[model samples]
Target: NAGVTQTPKFRILKIGQSMTLQCTQDMNHNYMYWYRQDPGMGLKLIYYSVGAGITDKGEVPNGYNVSRSTTEDFPLRLELAAPSQTSVYFCASDSTGFYNSPLHFGNGTRLTVT
Candidate 1:
């Protein structure tokens, strides 16, 4: 089964545009997350879902939104894209939120806003 898959490996958006970064997992995990990383920096959580119909904003949720309608899918939305939002976006999932639970990550979506 595909652990985690993210579409649009790369994207270039003009200012004020909007986009959705798709993320799907087949692991039936209860916890899913979206994170973004700027060049040469650690990743920062943008949004997360504990389970279907349950979601919450993460550390940097200002320009994004997320929804988890099922255990296998969690999609992130970006509104009014800006240059500062240009970064490598990663989708991750884990069976548990514990520190020892292994986190599976997508290849990453590289977005560039001009």
Candidate 2:
């Protein structure tokens, strides 16, 4: 299984710009999630999807959006990038029926918005 994969491992954006962070998994997981990790901080959930066409906002969904149209893809979009949005973004997923299941994270995309 390839787990999760994110593109553009690093990025620098100016304020007000927009970008999409791509996420894909080959493990055929039914639950996928997007999270942001500020410097020295724990992961904060941004959005999640239980399955295709079923998505929900999370703790920190502001300035972001997500769509899960298939079991293998769940991409996150930042509408208007801000410095406060500058953080390491991670894409994760886990098997269904395992509420306590640990997430499989991608390498992470380090974003810096100035």
Candidate 3:
């Protein structure tokens, strides 16, 4: 089964432009998340959803938004992209909580906002 998938392996955006990073999973997992990883650091949670139609903001949710209308899709929206938002974004899923389960991650979307 496909765990999670993210599109646009790499992208370069100018300041103020917007883009949505796509994420989809086929594992039927109840938990989906969006995270950003800087050049040399661990993943920082951006947003998450417990299930369809229920979304929540995470640690670094600023300048970002998310929608969970379907179980398989949880796209992250960057309304006004800034240089500070430039990082590798990853989509992950977990059948259970972090304490009991490991997350499955996509290759990642490398975004560069100038």
Candidate 4:
């Protein structure tokens, strides 16, 4: 089974265009996270969820939104895509929210907005 999966491996959008970056996992994880990494920078948390129906904003939640309606899916929405939003986005999950739990990361979705 796929531990985690993300769609649209690459994308390009106009300044105001919008899109959804889809993420799903088959590992029955209780915690999931969305992160974005800009060039020469570390990953910044965008949003996260502790379980189905429970989500919270993360370090950099502006310009984005997330929902966790099920244990298998957590999608990130770009309301109005911007040049600053151009970054590599990743979705990760762990069975538990413990510090020692190994995270399963999906292949990143590279987005570029002009």
- What stretches of model 4 exceed 4 Å from their correct place? none
**lDDT (Cα, 0-100) at 2 in candidate 4:** 78
lDDT per residue as tens, model 1, 5-111: 99989999999999999999998899999999997889999999989999998999998988888899898998899999999999999999998998899999999
Deviation from native of the Cα of residue 76 in model 1, angstroms: 0.7
- Clashes per candidate (backbone, < 3 Å): 0, 0, 0, 0
- Candidate 1 residue runs with Cα over 4 Å from true position: none
C-alpha local distance difference test of each model: 0.94, 0.93, 0.93, 0.95
The ten-residue window of minimal lDDT in model 1 covers: 65-74
- For all predicted structures, in order, the TM-scores are 0.96, 0.95, 0.95, 0.97
Cα lDDT, model 3, residue 58: 92
**Model 4 backbone overlap count:** 0
lDDT of 3 by residue, 1-114 (tens): 667999989999999999999999999888999999996778899999999999999999999999999999999999999999999999999887669799999999999998
Candidate 2 per-residue C-alpha lDDT over 15-61 given as tens digits, one digit per residue, 9 for 90 to 100: 99999999999998999999999867899999999999999999999
The true-structure Cα RMSD of candidate 3 reads: 1.1
lDDT by residue (tens digit), candidate 4, 18-37? 89999999989999999999
Write down the worst ten-residue block by lDDT for model 4: 94-103
Q: Residue 41: error of model 1 in Å?
A: 1.6
Instruction: Give the root-mean-square deviation of each candidate in angstroms.
Output: 0.8, 1.1, 1.1, 0.7
